[model samples]
Target: MLSCVVLWSGRRGSRELPRLRPRVAPTSLTRVDFTELVPEPIAFLGQAAYIQLEAFENLARAVATAPSLGAKEGLSAAAGVALRKHHDLIAELRRSGVEPVEVMAPFAPATDRFREASVGADWYELLLGIYVTTGMLDGFFARLSEGLPNELADRVRRILAEEGASQVLRHELERAIAEQPGLADRLALWGRSLVGDTLLVARSALRAAEPSGRIDEDVEPVFTELIADHTRRMDALGLTA
Candidate 1:
């Protein structure tokens, strides 16, 4: 969904940097200046990430239903990429400012849950939600894509129609859930972790920044309600424990 990469060099003195990239930050952290419009660069970049979630959730259903062993494993890998992309973006934002990442840390996924194999079900469920959230927000991209060369818009639309990434996530979810009976519990816990950590980091960002903290609509109540629904569904599925 991201059309191009903009690499940002962290803030220097009182001067703010500019948005430069769609990224995967280094495994070993790096620091840079804060760009003035770091989070909302090319409108679609932010928008696409938001709406990709719709496709993700739908695909998760496919994962739950897939019949092949190969197909199930595939969903896991695809979901992992989607999750990482999200992590990298937020990580990039935090790392760019003069502040240390630890001070404004993003999601810190539970090490233990990921370490155990039992968490596969939870992983698919959460992956689905993340996809749904991202996809729901993607609707705005049409406006963002407007005025671009016709070729780009056409290409993006084609990719969307195919639901490329979400398809991969679904394939894996089906396999994971079918094979990992306890996956539902594990995924529910993971979803809780994603929501909680996101809130913690969000509040921190809101507090640290000025009047209008986050401009993106996808980060607002609509997204929160969806997350709540996801949580409720998990509870209903008897994964509360």
Candidate 2:
């Protein structure tokens, strides 16, 4: 089963972004045997495709609202890359003999909720949100791809490995923070706030045989790596994670 809850919290500059709490109940303190878990092929393809599509859509919107021509161009380029990834995933879905739309439909609501709740209140926040969230999720999906059938896994990894606008987004964020040093603190908090919601989305993508859809304890290390990567991304921007 899936459930979502949003909590509002005040931030620096009085801005607020709603946090999406995880659906799974809290992890038990006791240790348990590890069981490897991987989402089924269709679930993997559908979720991966939808995320790229959402990234493209969000970046396209960012392009429109960007404060300068340079930012607009950079974001437009990033959006194009995301769109291309989406198309590639859709093609893979077709090759597997499933309708793209139907395969992707089941994931739309949860992913959409994630996007909406995590959206930033301004250009800086929005850009940071895009940078932080997408980087984390891409790392996640790429890792999950390993558990897929060999050929499909290779294809998915290659597609995700294609360079996107991480540099552009990073440059833009660093510039913003440098210009207004105060933004570092706020953006750092914003980046920290995003982890729970982002991880929840990642957890939901796992294929669970249990009726409750709880994640296996074995997956904790994967999440640990994802969090570490997220911290590095934040550090690269000179922000605390």
Best by lDDT: 2
Where's the lowest-lDDT run of ten residues in candidate 1?
1-10
Stretch of 10 with least lDDT, candidate 2: 1-10
TM-score for each of the candidates: 0.34, 0.83
Q: lDDT by residue for model 1 over 190-235, one digit each (tens)?
A: 5444443233322223222322543343223322333344344444
- Each model's lDDT comes to 0.38, 0.77
TM-score, model 2 to reference: 0.83
TM-score of 1: 0.34
